[model samples]
Target: MSFPAFDAHHPPDKDLIDDCVHCGFCLPTCPTYVLFGEEMDSPRGRIYLMNKGLTEEPMNDQTVRHYDLCLGCMACVTACPSGVQYDKLIEATRGQVERRYERAPEDKAFREMIFQLFPYKKRLRLAAGPLRLYQRFGIGDKLRKSGVMSRIPARMRAMEALMPELQKEQKVPELTEPVGERRRRVGVLTGCVQQVFFSQVNSATVRVLAAEGCEVVAPKDQGCCGALSTHAGREEESLNFARKTIDTFEGLNLDNVVVNAAGCGSTMKEYGHLLRDDPEYAARAKAFSEKVRDVSEFIQEIGAVAERSPFAVTAAYHDACHLAHAQGIRKQPRQTLKQIPGMSVKEIREAEICCGSAGIYNMVEPEPAAELGERKANNILKTGAEMIVTSNPGCMLQIQASLKKMGHDGLPMAHPMEVLDASIRGESVETLLRR
Candidate 1:
């Protein structure tokens, strides 16, 4: 448990590193550690490097390499008994890297594009619609088979494999009324990728929120949560988006800012710090952050489900790393899944392990991401489940694409909110059932 003794070039907050007791309990859960079997890939070891970095210790190539390889999955944060706040450590280190280091031209361009486009909803929608053509035309299949992918740079190929086919999008209407009396008024975030990729998840989110006697606002003004940007250390752009978000929902008489996408929710919850430097929007940003809630947790808090009926479908609930670890929400989504009639929630092994879709990590680091996704898919398959339920759009794509590649693609992938809505509305989710 003895950590490396040295000062980083720029030390992080003393309180953060001091929380790590250097417990190696998180070693097995880390994707990089599991893959490379290197001490530096382990949580304790990373903390050591982070500590060293923050303490002003000199960085070697090895230190940078391991940090670069990190998915920032936060599985270690969940596994640590001492409650080491690895999420902050990793993010702080990443921000420092972005400020101080230089990446290759392609890496810089792609990462910049992700940060720029992802936080702006119009840009995302406009971009996604055309990309949909490439996906549906099976360009991915062509690339995989043509050896053209081999000729390209590894990182670019990695990006291509991460995208899944987008069916027609179904953006929610601006306002939706619940079936019964309104008990709460909330704003639902129509996330960037969720809108273009898993639009149905947003639909179900509105349906469930409505079914619970709440009025839902799918505000056209609420853009992305700046998640992909923030996670990649594009701090200024993320902060700008955060300001717009504050202005987006400023007037809503909201009980909460309900977020169905876990990664977005996690990012939103951290808006306090994301905009800390904004003189005009700092207070508003923090206020907006406090109002943010994961849809499942909001549902749980409002007693959205009165009872759980026994359903017979064997369903596996895949926990998105951001939801379970970064945001510290591990139970409500499961409860919602269990509420469906004739459904059985089955637990998968290594459920907390990253499916390798952290922000754009899958696209940027495709091989490892794919390996993790396939590993996750295999474990999910062993559950004998008829369907897999998850919260994040990225996780949905990663798992669904992996399952499809493995020929188990026929099995369904959906958000838990969808399941809850289907049960209450007695609506059959056939599209959800379809791969």
Candidate 2:
């Protein structure tokens, strides 16, 4: 196939792109390629454009457009047999786009708004009240139905649709007293989105940690993990946010910095790498990163995790890509669940695949995201699990929405901690929600 001239605006590293062997392994698994039959949208083609863009050639609008459409989902990295390191490639490319590409002001504004509010927990919590008013008056519905978003660019349209639903005002309590024999002391990350939206999940995580014999310290000074900002290539903003988070948690002499949200966990665990340039914080960041753990990893490691799961329930488990593939944490969550005495954790087909919820992708790219979610929902349907367990709040919302659309009722999605809490208490799992 003939290639177009590359644009200088979105430069990828040449060495990384050269590593691609033109293997088709990444094609079948790409949600976009899997849904749409365009080779230009496939991993192989994206790499080709990246190679040209790296060499100072002017990349054509078509080439740049294709790259702009990428969701940066990292599936290509998982699928690439050649180890092309698409993570860095895509991240750098996005940075170049932000610096050199002339995106519409409206588009830039929308993208910046998320970074402005989402990484600041207090700001996000304060805005939730007004957002509820928008939802209550059906303003969002009217705007969406009016097709007003079409007047803007595709990227902006994607951003608008991803607007989060009305959220609750939930902030972490400074300290949660220990419940059982307190064997360990640890800190739990209060994520910006999870704090305001999935307040119950974070609360359940605190309860579970306490029941498992750990003093759960929810430091109000703790800042957002800045995963969303970093993923979007807002380097300066993300670095500041990361530094603040490190500063907040480092003061606590804790065994582990436990995070319930898989996305935040993945980012917090990489603090060492993020702050490597800092002479003072480098060692401290490494030490802190070492302490960082997903709630499942912490539970499995501590061995204080309970096993007397007296409730009988059928549930399907959805693995978060950030937890499983990004952090190499595949077993602990399932193991934690299987330990529950009476519950059966049914295996979901294609468990390794993402359920169309790579951080903010579902809200941003609703069409393709919904398509993949429906496919995942069908797979879950065969398992016939009454409830679904996923570690990340984003996946829970995306899957739950798909389940609702498919007319599955009362199968509210929950975190692994909720079940872990029940198992340790020797109470029915249903009590956590009902009570």
Candidate 3:
């Protein structure tokens, strides 16, 4: 068998690879393995390929293909009894693949476009202008109903369909004071796509934080947290972005840097490790990382001071992989949401399985992402909930697209904070749905 040439830089750690006992714990939890029943797509199988790539074997095209298929959802890490650090191994292997492997021209172009646009808030906002116009004019709806959209590339159609109705951006202010007494001061991350598309979530987050006796500071200049690039194996690029984020948030003597987006929160928490080698930013990165917390996690930790008014809605909670699997934050969000009176938080089937919105995975790997979205949507429908509550913008978009595809777009979804914010403000669940 022919293997691709290897670059010694960013080699997969032998110790981390060895930690995978190959006892099949990760196989059942792996999305790719679940879909194709292919051993090579499983965690241990990928580790084996990483080992081969490190052992002077050519990291052939097929090897790169397997790694590309991985969602990097870290479900395997959550399932493994042995505590195998599959996250580190996969990330390191991805860096190697980017450095040593060559992709098809078209695939390379699509990836470059994503890397260029999605990680920058200004770029995403600028790009959304046309999409907003498309959605506003009902062009997308007409095209889809007439089957013309299907004629477009599947990924392109999927991208078009995934565009949420972009409203005027609700920019988070530089500082928000608490309603009563300020118990703590925190920094909020206004993510790239998040600030543009789901700014409502950020607004709700700030309101909820203030209502809970916290002073929130959202740095106007904060950029992407490098979750997308890091997950994709663009190590150097991700590191640069991480450094910028670290610098932006470090200026505030924040007791906690609150993050509402699951992927951003996960990457921010790992900033210390991502920039551990940078002499200038290493210690600062570690210090900044120590203060990072998922909004739900932070809410639960500090305790919600505001009284939650009743919100009458049956809601299915979809666990974002980064929030649940990556950060072990399954319960905090649920616990925070349950605090709302008259709210029913139903558990969906396969709650631990990824909804396949792993950063930009839905955009790049639309086929598998669509399948997983369908699976998640179906399971969500089974709960008979009026709304699906999740913590990540990616999950919100993916689940909404899947529901639309399944002819069930009537069901509205929300970030947990939105629901909580509604209850706290005595707003009806209808207001949330209408928005």
Best candidate (score: TM-score): 3
List clash counts for every candidate, in order. Answer: 16, 5, 4
> Which 10-residue span in candidate 1 carries the lowest summed lDDT?
1-10
Model 1, 307-339: lDDT tens digits are: 433345678989999999898898888877766
Cα TM-score per model: 0.91, 0.86, 0.97
Name the best candidate (by lDDT): 3
Model 2 lDDT per residue over 71-150, tens place: 66666777777888777777766666665567667766766776677677678778777778876898756875798746
| lDDT of the candidates, in the order given | 0.79, 0.75, 0.89
| lDDT measured at residue 146 in model 3 versus the true structure, 0 to 100 | 97
Candidate 3: tens digits of C-alpha lDDT, residues 286-307: 9898999999999999988899
Preferred candidate (lDDT higher): 2 or 3 = 3
Q: Candidate 3: lDDT of 55?
A: 72
- How well does candidate 1 score on lDDT at residue 3? 18
Query: How accurate locally is residue 401 in candidate 1, as Cα lDDT from 0 to 100?
Result: 75
Task: Give the runs in model 1 whose Cα sits over 4 Å from its true position.
Answer: 1-11, 277-279, 305-311, 429-431
